[model samples]
Target: MEDKKRVGIWIRVSTDMQVKDDSPEHHERRARYYVESRDWQVEEVYRLEAVSGKTVMNHPEAQRMLQDLRSGRITGLVFSKLARLARSTKELLEFAEIFRREGADLVSLAEQIDTSTPAGRLFFTIVAAMAEWEREEISSRVAASVPIRAKMGKPLGGQASFGYKWHDKNIVIDEKEAPVRKLMYEIFLDCQRKKTTAERLNDLGHRTRNGSRFSDTTVDRLLRDTTAKGQRLANHTKSVGEGKQWITKPQQEWVIVPCAAIISVELWEKCNAILEEQLSKRARKGRISEYLLAGYVKCTCGTSMYVFSTAKKFTCKNCKNNVKVADMDEIYQQVLKGYLNDIEPKMYVEELEKAIAEKEYLLTTSTKKRAQLRKKMDDLVPLRVSGDLDKEHFAAIYQPIVAQVHQLDKSIPELQAQIDFERIQLNSTDHVLKEAKGLYESWTKMLFPEKRAIIETITEYITVGQDTIDVGILHLSPSSKLTSQHQFMGSWKLPT
Candidate 1:
């Protein structure tokens, strides 16, 4: 084991690792010095560039080194600094354990530490903690910076998205994609007229970026997205829960560069409003019955019970339960009305309005922070002229601070756009509530079969128990599995 000639060299560079100065050359020279002093023959040097030192697993070079260790090919691993290998103490200890188990040594030239020593392990614990802190500080510093550039209508990311071209200061609209965007709006109108949807367009044959056939999801994204018109997407809020993701309509969150506008803002808003209106109507009317939750309810078998009536028998084909259509319909209607009465939609709207106002308040705080960061960065200009602070420190402090200002710059505008989006939704929700209020009275007067159609449109699935029923209403639009269905619990025995 002592006579083993296999050796591994791992090299990593964050953006600053390689400089015009002797920093990188010094790192290489020191590494080579140790290799020459010891008779360890050069096997493989894994060099990773433009990567961060914050994550040990993510770095390509580190991954390669670990792979060689697992393969029993590496007798030893060498780095200049412990930070070059890991950012966290926990991760450093993991590597230490791996090397110890493999009968291999982990050594750093700068720290003069090796895994063979108990002292080296202690040194690593301290180095890893510092590295972790530095990584987190850099992250917060970056988060504080991006909005300023976005606010100025400057291109922050490397390139533009699908429908726009990146210019020096702003993104120009791509004329070719703009027409296809307009077509998306027209298609939604056609769907309303035919009482059909873009789902057919997908089935017929259309392919998107992934080479998969077009789906209703693709059409839905196009209709809801504001970006296709060469405008920024509004209220692009992202939330992750239970390892699931949800991306909603582009609320009013946008940084519209006057120079970047390709489609009129009015036109963009009009397209979305039209599409939303048509979808809501279709989802309610399109279902077979007014059972609001028709598609939503699942049988014990996990299959959906079909909402169908043949002659006087209402049956779940999967469950084989023959129910009276009139009785089931009445039960579903009563369940829905009961749940709506509990909600007090008007009160819900008021709560949402207050929440939006708080976000707008945060926007002001963000704007003030940006002003401070910008003013501080400007004060550094005099230091740059007089040489009080050298150019290097100036850049280190100023560059990151400037990025902070840019990020702050975009935050408030994005928040304001969100407030606008929520306002629109609040209004729509109020209107929808008004519509829901009349449902019970309207349902009683309609024909049993006609009422059935209305029930299926609003209800996703109708689940019947011995003396109880679960009616799920399709609160969201129809042509979408994206609809919101509120489950209404009710007993067939009416309240005295």
Candidate 2:
């Protein structure tokens, strides 16, 4: 009997909700039936769960299936539909080329495409061309519709921005977030600095629509975006290469539709002017202020913390976890003390061991060279004793070697000193306690960069809650006693 065709099945569902639906199961059963009816052997099943078909490269299982086909593990590929395999025309063509090169057939059961015959090849070619054309047409329609939507003064359709939310497909003021928006504008106009404005907003527990912490870049963008000012600007660009490249049009081509403004035009202009001035200054100086706990701190709401300077505190962008610098200092000191005073002092010992290992690694090359030089000097002595060399000649070779050995002798002691210093500290809780206390006392005097580095080195994250502060330690995993993400630091009513 002729060998049965070997084929692999491919399937994808865009979201978890689809998994609960019987549609994916139905498609799989249909695909399996189609393969079995053709008397083909099922080689493997490639399933991409909860992944969108919009991007071809995002599916790992699909890529693996292609590899298997190329390696001759499977002679044919089958799927319920073409869209299940790929959505983009580029991806479709690429898949076609792969199957053609590998002498494999593709069967998309729903599309009735069986690329093993000449008639099937013609049908698929026509269908693929229509699919590519439809994609382009849809994109063009959407681009053409933007102006009409903008002219009607409605959102072109996406998640609502800060200070506003979607209501019946129209942008409406979000009463709760509006005040925060006003606060951001008022603070920015007052400070005339985007970083200061960002800090102030964070201090007040305001965040962007995405719940991420504010930065100067985000602050500047928010200040300059006309959407917040209740103006709809659309048709910013048109498709240039099907849907690949987008070239922004000139300012005169922009569509401006009026809507409910979050802030007055006068206030917007004032803030923007100051922002422009700041940008020009930064351009000249080429620098911006750095936040200490920028990425290390996470809000209880699962967003990063943004450092604000209004009340001298680092605050969560997504929650009301605002904490004063002095209070942070106190909490941080307590956490350090807890680590240093542990019964085994295991954390300190780990740090000491790391330091010892690092020094030992650095000393290896130098130590080897020193030993080699010493051996050479000893060989010279034997050469001199055998009368193979004159006294002056032996001295010539011996002096530089001795000097080199002297240099190694100096370096070897320094390496030993480092090793011993770390070793001694492992046994001394007093040393750890004294060091922590010194850092605490001198905390106020350290440079901003220095203090930030030290805090980041010891801490994984510092999460603030309503009644407590939690600090995550670096060396120990999150489970360590001193490294709890929710340890209570005595409650204090934070300043509003």
Candidate 3:
């Protein structure tokens, strides 16, 4: 039998009048009825009552809904209308992107849009494309003006570099900060280490403009800026996305605005030369992993084993235990084949689903109990206000209820977290099962890197004993996975 689609109902009412006319409960009921018509289960309800729709992506309820969706606790979201989901076009596009990436669905009743349907998917594509076009249009207009402003030596919409400030529409050195900036170059030249320079500056009680302790990255960025040498470069970089890293633009597009020099050009060149040499030396020593389980293998003595240079055996530094690389590889391949063939994903997922359902039920009953307790507490307040109860009586009644509510508050979240964790396991097992058959078929033909990638994906660790090899297998979703750092028992064992 096919599993019923699990979905969350979204309810956001911004105003008291809207609550009176439309109501969060009314919206939730409408969404629930729609879900029921399709035989989908309403797993959760995110209520954002009296919250602004203008920017709800950061709201606690919205975050919880997203978390549930991402963790696979729910696979879809149902709202009364698109506006209830989000009024902002950008946020609407973001929601669609997230749903699409997670292989989930979005259903809006009033708009008659369901991303599970072809027509609804088409509607989302069109809306997202239009939003992207609008954003690009605005971005291009801004980009066109940046070079002109840079060439004219005008402020380009951000604060000047740390040692300099924008004064009267001109870039000038900040007196107090310039000395510290110059000292950074001096320290780097003496020590030839960016980390050392940062530590020395921090020890001298110098901090960044934001008042944070200087770090190696901060020191490196300050050292690399050409503004210290008087030629301030602008329009040299472009951001790939919101909150993402910026990459260097084409050199021909760069604009250099002349500014006051902090240090001599000779000193700047010498410092950068040393940095380039150090980077080159590090790059020369870098090498790719030659063995399939280079990092995953560990000695049973609780130490990592590695194949030393010109050695064919993975040797443990602590216990002197060793295993031939080829033998270990052979054992791993046999283990991999058995592990992939042995996975009973359906049975495993059923167990996880049963656990999740139990936790969800517990969370629901606890929430209801808390609400009832809260109502009782509210009623007691009115009794005291009306002088129907004495202060001692009110206290006697309120304290226990408050204690029960607090306990429930803590327990309910714990239940929900357990549900979220099991749902992640359920999703990960599904993903690995779907991929395992193909991976096994292709394993013989895959190159070292390809095979290594799969090992990193499914393997928790490999422990090498004197006469036995044990492998721990854990298939985790890229978005949510327990770290292998936590100890896990081996799932496969072989006699050496």
Candidate 4:
């Protein structure tokens, strides 16, 4: 009598509807039945409830199952489908490699992919390649549309620059922030110092859009941005690699859209020239890592907190409230862990997928309808030429067909553009999910720059109060109206 094969079940459903309709228990039961048919003993079940399939390798349940497979606790993993295992081709390949190295098998019931056999292995490879190809096609389409959208002055994706707002697809100078932005240039010209300008702005009670005090870095960035001089540059930067580090695109590829200038071009040049001269005079030093929460930390008194050169604490100049640097960092790390854990990727992914599907369906039907109309128009043209139809009859029938075809011609591209936008959004969500997975576990090992990038991407602002700390997290979806705030007790005493 041969010993039965041991396998672990993997279950991940991404939405409440999925949980209700195609429940994890149902998936597990089906997998168990499949395992019974193969005489495989079910050893463990790994459930990733409401978790995304974007990147599961770093997920806790995924790690547990991988551990079992490696340790010979289970000889195989059975999931409902390949997507339930992972949507990312790279991750799917990684899982396959691990399974091969560990002498284990992967069985996805939906695709009938059983890696215990040579044919199954080949099938898995083909499917993974197809998935990769599909992802690349979507990405290519989105990238191609970007320049077209940018050239047309369409609001690409992100928020407009600090002093401007996007209204009705047009960039306009913000009424309240415009004066403050213009004042930044004037102050910089008079003082010739970014720090002094920031100090003056803070003194005058001018805060950033998030209501945080301006820093020298913020002042420098605002002054250097060409948007203030009327030419708002778009498609000038691209995110590179897994870290999503942004790098400048070539100048030739940049699309410059003219907008209302916040300040005179002469004044902008003069301020920038002074900055250039100062930069040239200064000794070039290695870039220093800024505080983890620089411009983000705010006081309850509605003032921004700063860490001075002589102090080891974040202090509010207005209220003199302070917390030790180490303590604040520890608190932030804890808050970050909670925030990442609470994120529900399904909610955002579901909405994007729904929108994309609707647009794609509309595009397909419209395209077919347009073809039919064009054929009718073409058939009428021949009849009119042969005198089978009178001129008035041809005009009545052919003109309506031409108009319908024309309307679809206009609408099809719009539908595709909308689909492209949703695809881009879905890609972005996947990137965020991948970055977030195992972030808390790997936080301590990350470099200063990497940690800073995550903070800037996810955090809106952090408020330090006398008895509490409030962290305002940025929305996962652009359309999300919900603001996430995590409050922690400030029981830790400040230094005397």
Candidate 5:
């Protein structure tokens, strides 16, 4: 009796493929059939489900299979398709060399490439090159489509902006969200400060698209988006490999689609002018301190605090509050322990899951409502075209619907953002706790900048008072470092 050949099967499916029900089982069945047809025994199966073929770094099962192959445990490796093995040509060639060196045969059933023959090996390389070229071609085509869509005032793809909704392949304003955006502009223009504006918005129960409390950065970005002004600007950036690089396209090249402007052009310009002035003022301050707690520390006397020249003390410019840097560090460590201790990781995870589910539900309901509005607006289009509805009446009716759809567009993204944030927090809860402990223990070895960064990451700020030190804990997923650092004073006191 011939010895049954030991073979390993590798199965993987991308996210898109998985959603379509093209599961790993289908790949497994094919591999089993191929191996059994040759009277080979299945040594093991390595399955990667809903995982992208973009990189092997995240696939631990694939790594284990390779390790077994390298150890000469398997005589053959089999997969249903070449692309399933890897999307990159470079990785494919590397895998071929490994199989060749390990004395293992490579089999791709779809392409009918068996690496036991020199002709088959050559054909595998050609197929890998073709697969890679096809992937790049697809990426290029998708990237090129963005500007074209933007020019036509269609949905720019991805998440719809705040106060906008997707309808019949176009982006229209959401009525519910448009009021919120308009309020944001009004509040921002009135306050002329991102931090204060954020605080006021949050006070009014206004959460960002992600369902988190507003931050200065979020407020600033929302104010800066030209889309709120009813204009779609395109070609502001170009693809850079796996990322994008910003390139200021000429004004002439910018595709402007008239949107439902939430704020007037005049209001937008006025707000931006104030922002530019703030930027100029900040630029003039110059980067001077390398103190670990320079910008993060504040004085209870309502003044900015900085690292005193010796780096041993933090001095508040307005209140003459001074505290030893070491005192601040010790207090921070103690506060961190209490803060982390209060958080039950398991409960936190459950809470995050619940929050995510709630947001997802809200998005679904809002999307349905937006769809209804879209239908009404689409129905109006025919009336306008058939002269049954005059342009003014059509505008009066359709404008409100368009505004409502756009509002959902803003709301959906906010809910999605919150869901994404919570999911991330769930994943990192344990790591964050471990790192907090490590940061405290490894403080002595860290440089000033490293120490400052770690403190900034964990705590919102340290405030020095005449007899007390307040260290406010930045929430787990902090949006921005508190601008008015002494706004919330923690109960921690300085060592006498």
Candidate 6:
């Protein structure tokens, strides 16, 4: 046994995977059978039951396999299918690189990929295309079904949120969550008058599930939530161009069972009217003057400079440089055009595509890492419970790990939110590229600011220097201003 070569078997089944009697155990036995038949040591069976093998990001066994490979512990990975290994083609390629670097081979029984054979490599190529196509197909089907589901007032799937409870496969009247729901409606209604309802709620001792005090935006989001009124499930949908929608799909959808309604549809509509009325009032507050080099440009004075929207003019209060509110849009148009003119648009798009891939990777990996850490912490709890250490000693050691876990847990949701937002922005990347091929399209064709708003939201100002320009972004401090993503490139120069 000591002289025998080591092998690891990985299995992943999605939550939706049908089970017959002891299917997982059966898979385990089959994996064992395969490993035992080989002249290899069955070192470990990393079983990821009820997990999605499609994504390495959230898959535990996949992460463990990669770790082992990096450590040069294992030389083999066997899975039932290629899809049981990874979902994204990019991820599959990434796995291939990892395997190739570590002198490991991927063995997919169903796909008959041995990684050592030419035929196996060819199988991999076919699998990659199939995996990509399957992913896109699933996404498109979900997207198309959303509008129909929203129209049907079905419960889109989600956990029983703070104020809801599971009743007969559907979330029903949770009295504890009911008051918060009512408060949300009232807050939405009162926000029109700047009523500070969230502050009031906090004073009244209403906390979120995480025991956090509420802000106005949180209150507003809750008020607009269709789930509170039993009009829709707790799932998300694309709300673009015109109307908002929710989606539901049989068992996949959030159970949209009747719960005691916190507010009526009529009342919800009234709340929306209040939001609209307040929005109009805010609109009357005056134009939002955006700057061209807002995020990536910095000031010479070494202060955090930004385009301050005043009634009279858009001014850099720190540097005291005045940019007329009317001229700001034209300047941004110039800046974007200048970027395209200076750099190749095709090249820039390619760079952006790479960036999107990297960002998505980072996001997914973070989620996976957080889950792994939390799993560790959950496992450790039993040791602590068994009087492994005194309370003080336990606190001294475990507190930081627990805190870090909490931070990661919080981060996952925020990262998911950002991903959701960016997905919306990048949905029309090809269209945006097409638009760029033509002359700079007019801004303000839509009420919402698009590219300029995004740039300004991220940047502070571009700093002019003899050699390079510094792009500053959302800088609150002097040091932060210098270090922002404001790139100083060889081809680019800042405005004097």
What lDDT, from 0 to 1, does candidate 2 have? 0.70
- How good is model 1 by TM-score? 0.33
**91-172 per-residue lDDT for model 5 (tens digits):** 7766765676566788776565655433355555664566557668887888777777777767655766788877887888
Best TM-score among the predictions, by candidate number: 3
Over 4 Å off, model 6: 1-135, 143-154, 160-162, 186-195, 209-212, 227-230, 233-236, 239-260, 264-270, 283-496
* Predicted candidate 5, C-alpha RMSD: 28.4
How close to the true structure is residue 8 of candidate 1, measured as C-alpha lDDT? 74
* Candidate 3 runs further than 4 Å off: 1-49, 57-145, 162-223, 240-243, 259-288, 298-304, 316-322, 343-428, 444-450, 460-468, 475-496
Candidates in order, TM-scores: namely 0.33, 0.34, 0.51, 0.42, 0.34, 0.32
Instruction: After the best TM-score superposition of candidate 1, give how far the Cα of residue 305 lies from its true spot, in angstroms.
Output: 6.1
Candidate 1: stretches off by over 4 Å: 1-311, 316-320, 386-397, 409-421, 445-457, 474-496
For 362-443, candidate 4 gives per-residue lDDT tens digits of: 8888878877777777778889999999999888888877788667655565454455445544655655665576789999
In order of listing, the candidates' clash counts read 42, 0, 0, 0, 17, 20
Candidate 2 TM-score to native: 0.34
lDDT of 3: 0.79
Once model 4 is optimally superposed onto the true structure by TM-score, how far is the C-alpha of residue 107 displaced, in angstroms?
38
Q: By summed lDDT, which 10 consecutive residues of candidate 5 come out lowest?
A: 479-488
Report lDDT per candidate.
0.59, 0.70, 0.79, 0.79, 0.70, 0.58
Better of 1 and 5 by TM-score: 5
By lDDT, who's the top model here? Answer: 3
Over all chains combined, what TM-score does candidate 6 have? 0.32
Q: Regarding TM-score, does 3 or 5 come out ahead?
A: 3
Judge candidate 3 at residue 279 and give its lDDT. 84
Error of 1 at 464 (Å): 2.5
RMSD of each: 26.4, 28.8, 12.2, 25.0, 28.4, 20.6
Model 5 bad stretches (over 4 Å): 1-136, 139-147, 241-247, 284-496
